[model samples]
Target: MSLSLRPARRDDAALILAFVRELADYEKLRHEVEAELADIERDLFGSNPRVFCDIAEWDGAPAGFALWFYNYSTFRGRHGIFLEDIFVRPAFRSRGIATALMRALAQRCVTEKLGRFEWNVLDWNAPAIRFYRSVGAIPLDAWTTQRVDGEALERLAAG
Candidate 1:
């Protein structure tokens, strides 16, 4: 299928947003997607970008993307790549596109001497979990993820 991966460009913001919506819909979290094209552009293509995205193309067409950012691990005393999202269109699944994306990220970790490469998957996503496990990803089962967003996040910032 001639798949290739490349760093996303500023012109790809709309496509990336479309992929985000598709992924949210698949995960049944469409209602929670508050991201807009402007946000994507500013965050990913600004003068000092905090996030980055890699696009996967199959036969010169958009197939998927992986969005990530650097995160610090105080215990490890180094930076790691925190994968914010990885999504492949349904028609492109099971074609090693996702694996290729992950492999590229792992390569980055190795080259950059990063302490870890990690991401979270929903508990109910058995297929995704299986794919991750097959790729030698270990689950941090003991760690429960917690987040404060929306009004709570604003309140915390105000304090």
Candidate 2:
């Protein structure tokens, strides 16, 4: 199967949203999909866009995508790329699509001299964990990921 990767465009909002919902469904958190295409379109294509994405095509059809953003690394004293999401459709799994998508990001890091590439994986997702390890990523077991959301986040911001 022929596969191609390219930067996402404003016209891809609907496809991206569909892939995101597929991801949420796979993770059994479909209810958490509160985002709309309008929000994605604005955030991805606005004058001061907050994030960026790349799309993967398998045999000229949308097969997967990777959304990412740049972040500052105080320790490295340089910026890094944080992969927010990477998903390959079930029919396209094990066909090297995910690897190609990640390589696109890694190549960007090397070409741009980004400090690092970082992302989080669910603890229970063994297949993804194994795939990540095969690609030279080490598990950051020493660090715990944290977040503030919904009401607590709002209250904290107000205080």
Candidate 3:
């Protein structure tokens, strides 16, 4: 499959949202998705954009996307790319699209001297875990991911 990757445009919000819902469903967390296409458009293309994305097209059709953001690591004393999401529809899986997207993200790290690229995978997602292993990513077994979400996030921010 011929794949092309480029920065996503505002017009692609609907497509991006569709893919995001697909991912949420696949992960069995569809109910947690309260976001909309307008949210994506604003965060990705607004004056103070919080993130950037690159869409992947396979055979002239939207196949997947890589949404990422810059993160500062105080210990590392540098910036890194935090991969918020990378999803390729199942119909287009096993076509190296995901790998290609990761390669592009890594290349950006190297080109920009970003310290590292990081992301979290669901513990039950063996397939994704295997893929990350194949890509030479080592799991941080000693570290557990922690998060404050929803109302807790709001409460914390208000304090």
Write candidate 3's Cα lDDT for 1-159 as tens digits.
599999999999998889889899999999988988789989988898979999999988999998999999998899999998889988899999999999999999999999989998999999999999988899988999899998999999999
- Put the candidates in lDDT order, highest first: 1, 2, 3
Model 3 gets an lDDT of 0.92
Give the alpha carbon lDDT tens digit for every residue of 45-159 in model 1: 9999999999999999999999999999999999999999999998888999999999999999999999999999999999989999978999998999999998999999999
RMSD of 2: 0.9
Q: lDDT tens string, model 2, 1-159?
A: 799999999999999999999998887889989999999999998888979999999889999999999998999988999999999999999999999989999999999999999999988889989999888999888999989999999999999
What's the C-alpha lDDT at position 133 in model 2?
89
What are the TM-scores, per candidate, against the unseen true structure?
Answer: 0.96, 0.97, 0.94
lDDT of 3 at 19: 84
Residue 157 error, candidate 2, Å: 2.2
C-alpha local distance difference test of each model: 0.96, 0.93, 0.92
Query: Between candidates 1 and 3, which one is better according to TM-score?
Result: 1
- Among residues 3 or more apart in sequence or in different chains, the pairs in candidate 3 whose N, CA or C atoms overlap within 3 Å are none
